[model samples]
Target: MEKDKWDKKITYPDLYLQFGSEERSFFKEEAKHLKAKYDELGSFCELKKFTGGHDYIKWNEEFVKTISKLLKT
Candidate 1:
């Protein structure tokens, strides 16, 4: 979705996205689009790219890192 199409009246929470470099093209494009939209809207958004694929183990590690970072904020 485009940034202009987003509802400005509704508040959006901070976005934290974790994606693998070896992930599918479609998913990566979607994440990039979302990040672009958030950037255009001037909202807080983070996108972390890892050198891996769609694996649960990596996701679990990223999840822990995300949680830890969130906790520190």
Candidate 2:
């Protein structure tokens, strides 16, 4: 029998969650939980924790890198 899109046996698209290492404790914990859930569902996920806080300057670099990799242009 063919499996439906919503079936547990189906794998979803890639997921990327990037956060600041110096972010708030609670937010970090939340991110951990979210990543765990996606992992449990057999999804391709990536969690990148940088050495900076919730600053745009640090996030911009990582964002550009990730986008470049995805675009592959």
Q: Which prediction has the highest TM-score against the true structure?
A: 1
Instruction: For candidate 2, write residues 1-73 as lDDT tens digits.
Output: 1232344687777877788989998768867876776787888888999997898988899989998999996
lDDT of each: 0.85, 0.79
Give the per-residue lDDT digits (tens) of candidate 1, residues 1-73: 4444786565578999988999999879888998887887788789988989888899899989999988998
Off by over 4 Å in 2: 1-12
Candidate 2's error at 13, in angstroms?
A: 3.6
Question: Please, what is the TM-score per model?
Answer: 0.86, 0.76
Candidate 2 lDDT: 0.79
Global Cα RMSD, each model: 2.1, 6.4
In angstroms, how far off is 48's CA in candidate 1? 0.9
Error of 1 at 59 (Å): 1.0
Error of 1 at 2 (Å): 5.8
- Residue pairs whose backbone atoms clash in candidate 1: none
